[model samples]
Target: MLWATVDVWPELEQAVLVEASASVRKIGQSLAVGAIAARADWVAGDATIDLDGLGPADLVSAAYVLDEIAPASLPKLVGGLWRLTADTLLVVEPGTPAGWQRILAVRSQLIEAGAHVSAPCPHEAPCPLVPPDWCHFSRRVARSRLHRLAKDADVPWEDEKFIYLAASRQPAPVRAARVIAPPKTGSGKAALKLCQPDGSAGERLLSKRDGEVFKSARRADWGDTLA
Candidate 1:
């Protein structure tokens, strides 16, 4: 998400990268591109202290870092970050059971802390998906030759799947229904699995007989926000 933030908001003049340990190279990248990699200064043994000195940022990101902390300490950790977030808070986790659980928990905390959801959800209400299922999305990225050779992958590109939340103090723009999964398309019909504004999962079937809506479905893919 740090790399993504550089792309999403190129105008950001300053940023901070929170490290899991005293090692400043927490993110495995350089401090170039105007980011300050800093460790949590206020830490005791097995306890995470509040990072009040770091100050607030326009974009605060906790990327795959929370899984290292105990579940019981989540609320204070999340709430502290929430307080430091000036505009947006991006929390990213793996597409696994534990990761999804963290996403759900942190999302509820963010909502409770009065932050507005900016993506992947349309409202502050409870999540609609129950246990054994979680909300996640995939983004396709081109694989470098070295990557393809190392993984022995057939495709020239790979899908990076993750579960994340984008919350902000500012109001989010109008939302469109998200394609929670890949659309099932047929010769003249398409079946869309969506997470709607009401935070419920529903299937929308569009037939060619419906004309325009069908055309739109044909163009929609997984992870797309459709109107």
Candidate 2:
């Protein structure tokens, strides 16, 4: 519940706080939300800021921040974040090859610190993806008139691609393989690129001949889990 940021965006904080307050009021839990918000210490500092003063939280997140960090300082920063994470730590970055590489490096660092990979990967073993290939996902966002004007675009929506890692202090539960690409369906057959729990990744081809599995494959999307 503690929200901290390195940037000094008073307007951003106020807007989000107002929206959250409104949501709480609508749900008739304004008092409860108020108490939590009141207790939260909003600290604004750079990545190198001392975390010792921030205390521990159940969940810690570093979003769009790692890409700004120097390569040599990443380990130290990650170590500090992990230390403050009482349960889980989340890190997010842009969905580019370079961003994925940064996430991969952070994943290894967290694993070395005895953290478990809680998401995006079913296994804690080294990533199966090699150079020239990286793991990322996309979300479609509808653009507003102002947004369209700013970008000078005509498209109603755009894909916001990103990559993230979730690491937990406890071991992660067993999970099914993850789909890494958009499903390709044709001729009553479906092809999916999957990252399996066995620390391997490859394509899975299914046809109507496969029965129920084929039906499931047809409904699956990128980032979904498959058995």
Candidate 3:
């Protein structure tokens, strides 16, 4: 999940990774080595990180390690990490009920801690999808031969669904709306479900000849920002 972000954002090279066990550093190092940009100053360690000694980085990441920790320890952990973020910070967890709860809590805490929403979400406001609903995104992964055999899977591609958050210290981009579902286009009209900045959502229908709006709708996908 994070490797994808590192590939897309050129300025996101320097990274500060914190894990409680610190054993996950091996997996992180493998990804970084596989990356084309190896110039990154990789700083990987346990939870007791020295923010003052190392300073901030372009990216700060805490992966699946967070879900294992105590709920009461979250604020201190996330709050301290927020201050160590320079450009972006990402957190990834499962797509289950527990995962959604963590994401929701972290979302509010990030806003309160003054971090801006970067992706998979359009605004810093509360999430529109209330309980019984959750927001998650999938990254298509190509199945390796060994991977397929281990899982007894035949599909060549798989979508890894996970709840993630990307926040920055900068202001969020100005997006009028964000597409929350795959758009439907037919009969010279387009219909969309959008996530708005006010922490609510609505469906919109536009004619094919509606000019600018129709064009924008045609290009947007399930998780794209609608300008």
| Best candidate according to lDDT | 2
- Superposed Cα RMSD, model 3: 2.9
Each candidate structure's TM-score, on Cα atoms with residue i matched to residue i, is: 0.82, 0.80, 0.82
Candidate 2 regions exceeding 4 Å error are 1-40
Q: How close is candidate 1 to the true structure, as a TM-score?
A: 0.82
lDDT of each: 0.77, 0.78, 0.74
Measured with C-alpha atoms, the lDDT of residue 90 in candidate 3 is 85
Q: What does candidate 3's lDDT look like per residue over 1-227, in tens digits?
A: 45655567755545444444455666667767856463544445545344446677677777775788788878777777787788888888876668878977888899887788887677777787866766765568899999999999999778876777888888875746878766898877889888887778878898866898898888878778877
Runs off by more than 4 Å, candidate 3: 9-13, 19-23, 27-45, 48-53
Relative to the unseen true structure, what is the C-alpha lDDT of residue 213 in candidate 2, on a scale of 0 to 100? Answer: 84
**lDDT digits (tens) for residues 49-156 of candidate 1:** 747667777778887778888888888888988888889888888777688889989988888878899987877778888868777878888999999999999999
Clashing pairs in 2: none
Report the C-alpha lDDT of model 2 over 157-196, residue by residue, as the tens digit.
9998999999999987777888998989998999999999
